[model samples]
Target: MSDELQHLKAAMESMRGELDAMKAALSRLSRVVCIDKDDDGVETVHIECTDLLVRPWSDPRHLGVHIGSSEEGSYIKLYYHGEEHAAKPAISLAMHADGEPHIQLRGKDWKARTDICIQKDHGVVAVLGTNEARGAVMRAQPGGGSVAVLHPDGQARAVLVHSEQHQFPGSETARPSTDLIFANASHDTQMKLHTDDAGSLMMVGMAGHSDGVAVTMRKDGPAIIMRGVEDASSIHLMAAKDMARVAVNQGWLAGDKAAASLAAGGFGSSIELNECDGTKRVDISAMKDSASVQLLDAAGNDSVSLSHISGSHSSLAMRGVAEHDCIRIIANKDAALMRVTGPQDNDTDITSAVYEGKPHVLVRGRNRPLVMAGEAEHGGVVCAYGLKEVTGGVASLAGGPVSGVVSVSSQDGTPLMTLDGTDHGGRLLINNDLGLQRVVLGTKDEAGFLALNNTGSNGVIACATPEGGVVSVCDPDGNVIHTMPRLKDDDDDDD
Candidate 1:
């Protein structure tokens, strides 16, 4: 059993990684768009996209695009399934105070969501992001000018910025500067580089750099080397269409000095992956406090989910896999829960909850109750179940350490028998097909006795009283019809 559970956990974790990789392909915000329409019916016509597309920026020289709303005050925001005004945007493209452009990527806007900011300042651009609200700000700044990316927590990450422009000593003309920077989601710099007028390129690792690789280049590539600044080691790589090889402090060919490639980059605060067929078949993502992986069939028929929740909790579930919730597992807070279903046609399933706490288990089969077990405040509990007639009988037994009752019923819903651990002592009751109690043998609060009843609603045919062992025969109205006085020595035979 333990091995099985470990395998289950491993499978879940593996699927989670794949889902995270697949989330990059998932598309959230839709493409349907409406042209401009103000309260006065005056409109500014713009273009529409199926889902999302990048348009040309105002300045053709810039490689980026600026998306804006035709309605002057209206925001250009990515929406959920709701109306534009009814829902907050997950992403928004807006402007900086100085008329430069800025883009903000937000989560659900719930108290726990995160945001990413890409802003331009003084001819330079930076990317910033963060996790939960009031968390640290991930900063990536440029050499030209600074843009302060706000974090709810008011803390900033590490950053690096470097640049160098070349100019002739006697002339005012200056060549474009070579700029290099590595920043985290908080916009903090990790590594910075600047190429000198001599064409020498240099890079240095900053305080918070996760990847310690650095590039130091001379005039030509033959002598250039990208090394791990942290350990002073070189890296090597070989690329191809179908496969590639990579390593640190290694080489692919003889005399090929190690060098950094375009692949050198920082990981964002959040990563998403999805499948390309466009059905959103799989999605995987990860963040500081949580991770989510969603899976769907190729046709997008249904989904399964495996996720890590706030710190200590995790869950795995299948919805519509064979029928909604065909399987589910949850573990957290010193408790574990599990559920498994048999098939879609029949509602046969078993479930357990609070297994480490106050445990309970329920078993069922297609409108039929099989068995249920749990714990009561005073003691443990067990139940017997059945259908009206198909399964024969249904019964309930409940009690603590002191008292309890076990009652059984017939298939047609008629009471059959009942045994009671009563205050007067043990008691037995037998009911007829009409559900009327026709036989009762027990000790009452006063004394022990035996009773035989009639089929009438209120009838006692015979009774034996403990007082002097008096026996009476009664009519349906409960009137005594005969009496037998106890002899001096009468044997008590009660069954």
Candidate 2:
């Protein structure tokens, strides 16, 4: 009787172990079959449990369903809601390269709405979702937690998205290095721009509380964008290396260069170039409001090309043909120009330009029609143009308001140095070699002071300086032609 009982117990234990093994095998054999209503037949996929599911690419209205082993299946649908029948679904989804999920939505309509949610831990990528009835509307909300998207193509289109909250800052980022575009949306009464890297690029706030949208990039940055943000009101582009360093803001035909130091609203004024190194130039022909052009030279003569354009404003264009050359121009209203060539040497191009609503400007030339503004630390401005052009004890200055007296002196000035605040006069002091020096000011030229050697023979102006005991004159070939002593007497001409 005891042996029979033991045999019965062993048999039961063996059966239980077999059941457990069967359950594990069933779990590992699971797969998701992605089928599109537009497909020729039911396209099924047998995959590992860890692999992500993909919805067959199709129109926004096209439905894609996911079925898991031993569990119920879920379906994704598209919709639309906008004023003037403009609110429509322009939503699409896809799997990010990182194995996460993403959604692409465009608010092509004035006021539209849509929603997207993940019932599981899987990721998603949506390219475009448009309401078949309306032209093109991007409105949707992702109810799930934090997720990222990469939209290399959409970032070049400026497609609008409507969402409760998104994570894309258009400035300080590089995306879809391809055609122009990215992501635009209204959220919490402010319009926000989206990029591959969340908050790296952005657009100015639009009016009203509309759900915002998002945009992203694949892996690499694109090269040229034809009509990026063509439909948005204001768009901002920033460098990836330094989000706050260099940025360009443009919308409705106005362009602004910005630095990290300049306040948001303050950037609309003149440009502020603090610490930087390079050459800057501009051409007003391509600008929408180009009117007049001018050029300013400290000591040397400059050659410039001028033309008249028919826009509400005037513009100046320039090219950086030489290293360490500064270009400054003043114009009235907003304008644009083209570039003819790139900069010479390893120096960067800088422009010190302003739009004063006048009829004339001091700018002309271009290497390319597009302008690139970097960070404030690298010396860039918005609504203000600045370039680098300081050589031999001279620095560029702005013609804006001034504060307490700030002074910068050369090593010897080949002369002594002193400041007469009461008299409004200043002197240059030189102590070392005269390669290239820049005396900068926080304000414009009217209240600024600079002393240097290469004003293009303009002679040191208002500022005062001491004479060097010995002077040497060199020709264009860098050959010393003459030398004179400071204390030689008039009767010492015994040669």
Top candidate when judged by TM-score against the true structure: 1
Off by over 4 Å in 1: 1-285, 292-308, 311-314, 318-326, 331-336, 343-346, 355-358, 376-379, 388-393, 410-416, 432-436, 443-449, 455-471, 484-495
TM-score of each: 0.37, 0.15
* lDDT (Cα atoms) of all candidates against the true structure: 0.57, 0.33
Residues 85-124, candidate 2: write the lDDT tens digits. Answer: 3324455354434444444444656232333334345332
Model 2 backbone overlap count: 132
- Where does the lowest 10-residue lDDT sum fall in candidate 1? 259-268
Report backbone clashes per prediction.
30, 132
Which run of 10 residues does model 2 get worst, by summed lDDT? 258-267
TM-score of 1: 0.37
